[model samples]
Target: MLFTTCIEHLRTQPIWFLLISSLGFFTILKKSATFLNWVFITFIRDPKDLKRYGSWAMVTGSTDGIGKAFAYQLAKKGLNLILVSRNSSKLKSVSKEFQAEFPDTQIKTIAFDFSSDILEGVKEIEEGIKGLEIGILINNVGVSYPSAAYFHEVDEQVWMDIVRVNLEGTTWVSRAVLPGMLQRKRGAIVNIGSGAAIVVPSHPLYTTYAATKSYIDQLSRCLHVEYKHCGIDVQCQVPLYVATKMASDIASIKRSSLFVPSPDDYAEAAIRHIGYEARCTPYWSHWVQWCFAGLLPEAILDSWRLSIGINRRQGKLLIP
Candidate 1:
């Protein structure tokens, strides 16, 4: 009765009623769209038909972990691959493996260490990929601290390597590939990011790694807006954890699960989301974790992160 009376009263002021109803409808519609977007991302499964972007895909750190996984996934999509990594032999071996499996697809390898002069290495990449219709670039190469430590206790060399490999590598490699993509006027660039990049808790011990990934996140966002008009897509695929050598020091993620996925599993899901979302935690389980984490207060999350980092540091030190 009271609600009915209120509606009747508001109707007398027709403009006010119209404005309130419009605002309510808009808010409901906005929420519905957001819910539908998550549903679409979670349930839909499809292989990336990457030929629309270009004929070939390039992956840095292609010999192992997520980079190798991306290479395999792209090859499965019927695109030729340019494999870039530090080990010449490993690159050759991976190239041979892909050639055997995807017999119809062409494979090329470039040995470029991210820890070296990045510009020089990019020139090598440029030379290696010359005259090729390279359409996709996966900036997957990065380095992390050997173990978690206070910022002052970290070796200076370790800090330099992390910044050089994570920040400089992603920036330079993207630069090397963008010209070809622009000329083609269609391409996709996926830069691997970390959950530590302000997506979850504020990482306390591994400050450098988190900060570098933060750089990647911003770079991906800026590049997306800048190049979307040119038929290119740039995205940062932020993942939490995977059963890979890079994450071996973390005890909780030592084994792969639905949430903490294997590299191959994560890559399969990550590739599907590349051209669609600007910043995404590609695995469905990770999306659930992201949402759950969002509900906790920041103070609690900060303390939890600090404890985990300390435990991980002790565990790493105990290993002889």
Candidate 2:
């Protein structure tokens, strides 16, 4: 119906006009669903610019949960993939599912745990992806430890493990992939963060996780400013309490959309936004955070954040 009306509208334009502006637009709308799609297919789809970067996405910690969700959605977009996680079996299972469900998209997997030894893992990944052109980088790796203790009482190793997985792994993987993106002058890097960054002073259990997420949040915003001229889009997809094995039993998580989204569901929302049109997303909520960041005094914001961090635990860690 739209095409018909467009054609009718085109016919009404004077022939002299058709030879100019109207014809060019009519030709554009008729040829492709989108202006960019036409251009992409025509010039970038092949050995030429026609197929820019060849639909390869690398996702870290993708053996289960959110990372796996991203792999599935990218497959639908006709992307071949490199899936990474610690568990070889889980990676094989997800990769097999992708192959069976969507035969066209290729799938590759790497199973290296991102504990303190992540740098070695990154080097291995660099070697593995040497010749491939990865157009998308979804940094969905993270870790959350439950049961809070006083900051000093917490085990140092546990705290360090959180940092190694949440911050270091993400940093290393991005570093491994970024040189190519910089050289190509194009790519999308999405780091998963959390709502706690703005609202919580210090979540007893999630202290380190929140800090690393804050790092990712700021890193993405800075990268956007740093790389905007070079045609790179960097975004952080930050949210709260997902309903994975990690957060399933948490009482504060009330609903799906607000608190606990299934990984596939969240990935679907995130995959739709491959461009960094916004510094932060969950568009409305982050807009409010952006405004509050400017408006609220840091002390007042910290108090409010502390309340959110408490969840239902009354401004402290839940005790058994």
Candidate 3:
């Protein structure tokens, strides 16, 4: 009876019914297309072989976290590595580990801290990669607050260090490596970005960190346009809550879950996303989070993020 009444109502308001039906149909179609595209990119698309961009890959902040994971993954693909990190001892240890595991793959270490002199670090990288064809550059060196705090509550030097390491570091390193890639006429540059910038509306307490990552997103998009015709791919891979030392120490995410993947698992997905989009959230679960986050109102997101930031400031466990 309800169905027949609804059909009669629709017939009575034919134009209104048709317009509503059309709108509903198109919305479903658009959503379906989006879902299919995500599926294809996440699962079906074959990743480009890393060697085709160049025989060597350089990863910044490679002593630990996602950068280290990328180093191992690239080495597994038989590419020589130029690992850049701040700690000489840790760099040497990681270098030796890589060499032992992948005896056939060459490994080099450059111990230049991005938090220090930017130009000197760039010079070090330039000198290290002098003769090698560095086909891939991973601008993954970044720093975040130890814990969330209001903008004024954070120490001056702390924020300065974050800007220096996140923004200046990425800019100088990309500048140092671009000449070689431009000369070769083929390369890939993947900048690791955070979901704090792209996924939510406003990250209140971690303002500087999110702002820097937003800058990375813009930089990657512009570079992608500028270099696509030159056969270079520039991408910003925005990932959410990977279970690394950084996440554990900073965000209090102690355990890896469906949404929070281990560094290796995140990097495995991240590697497959290069040379495709200008920006992407590569992990499937992260993508799902991104999708749902997109559906909420900006005001609601802002409020939610602020509450989380407050919790972090209070030393509450984010994922216990």
Candidate 4:
């Protein structure tokens, strides 16, 4: 009887120990996912934090380029879309394209040109939205520098137009949508900014345009800090010469530093980066240049910028 008992104990010992070890391993693994999630994850840092949307998303300048890319990507992720554009026909075309691709999602178009003297139409857009949930708001539609010329030489109206569309439109849309987001305690704002916002080069066409982007950076930063505790995320998407109609002039589109990202790639990186990052420097080289700009003396920076090749031909911006 004693020998039989010893054999039984020996056989059960190994199996019992193995079972206990397996349970312990699984318990630790589960806790790790929970622990990491609880500690450092900020502003939808993981897939589990993703809040699904029921109602709407508004992207300004949605008919083309970065805005268009954001629309398609958001639609693919199952969000209902609102496409805004100055052209009804272009808006319709964009709406139709999305409708065909995402039969399951809702696509609406607002045909108001926010860039031209037609900003009087912004009020209509302000009243047009009704959302059960405004999950993602992308302030993307904006104008570019007209020509690489001096600041004073560029038409004053054009500069005003840039400020109106790029900065004011963003302000109005963000101000209009905040009530919904704050009430629900969930939403994301993606503001499209430029490298010029951080490193203002001396390009004639870029002067006023850079100022507009700087305003966007400041506004976005304030919103990010204000809403972070409330679970709302504000992000700025800055791309260095992303390939789109925006960069159609290939002759002058040299990458001063790194590889130029396609609009799609730029959108993907920007969309994935939610929350506070000083600015979304898409390329390492762009980031390096930006740091250099930050370190430069203001007078020196301005001097070098005006001296750069973009203005060497016709602009007497040298302020001699």
Could you estimate the TM-score for every candidate?
0.89, 0.73, 0.96, 0.73
By TM-score, who's the top model here?
3
- Residue 193 miss distance in model 4 (angstroms): 0.9
Q: Least lDDT summed over 10 consecutive residues: which range in candidate 1?
A: 311-320
lDDT assessment of candidate 3: 0.93
For model 3, how does the per-residue alpha-carbon lDDT over 195-301 read when each residue is reduced to its tens digit? 99999878999999999999999999999999999999999999999999889877887778999999999999999998999999999999999999999999999
Expressed as tens digits, the lDDT of each residue in 1-320 for candidate 4 is 99999778767788878788779999999978854653343234443222342357888888878889888878877788888888889988888889998999888788877765444666666667754477788899888665555677778788888888988889888877778888888788889888766665433346788888888988888888888787778877666566666554412443322456666666655665554463566444455466567767878877766555355435423221
Clash tally for model 1: 0
| Residue 4 in model 1: lDDT | 100
- The residue-level lDDT of candidate 2 at 171 comes to 81
Question: All models: lDDT?
Answer: 0.88, 0.71, 0.93, 0.71
Worst lDDT 10-window in candidate 4: 41-50
Residue-wise C-alpha lDDT for candidate 2, range 1-320, written one tens digit per residue: 99999999988998898788967888777755654653443335432121254468898878777788888888877788999888999889889988999998888888888885877888889987888888888898887655434466557887888899988888888888888888898877888877767444444445776788889888888887887677677888765555565554333343455435677776766665556343444423333345456556778766655554455344333321
Q: In terms of TM-score, how similar is model 4 to the real structure?
A: 0.73
Question: 58 in model 3: Cα distance from truth in Å?
Answer: 0.2
The better candidate by lDDT, 3 or 4, is 3
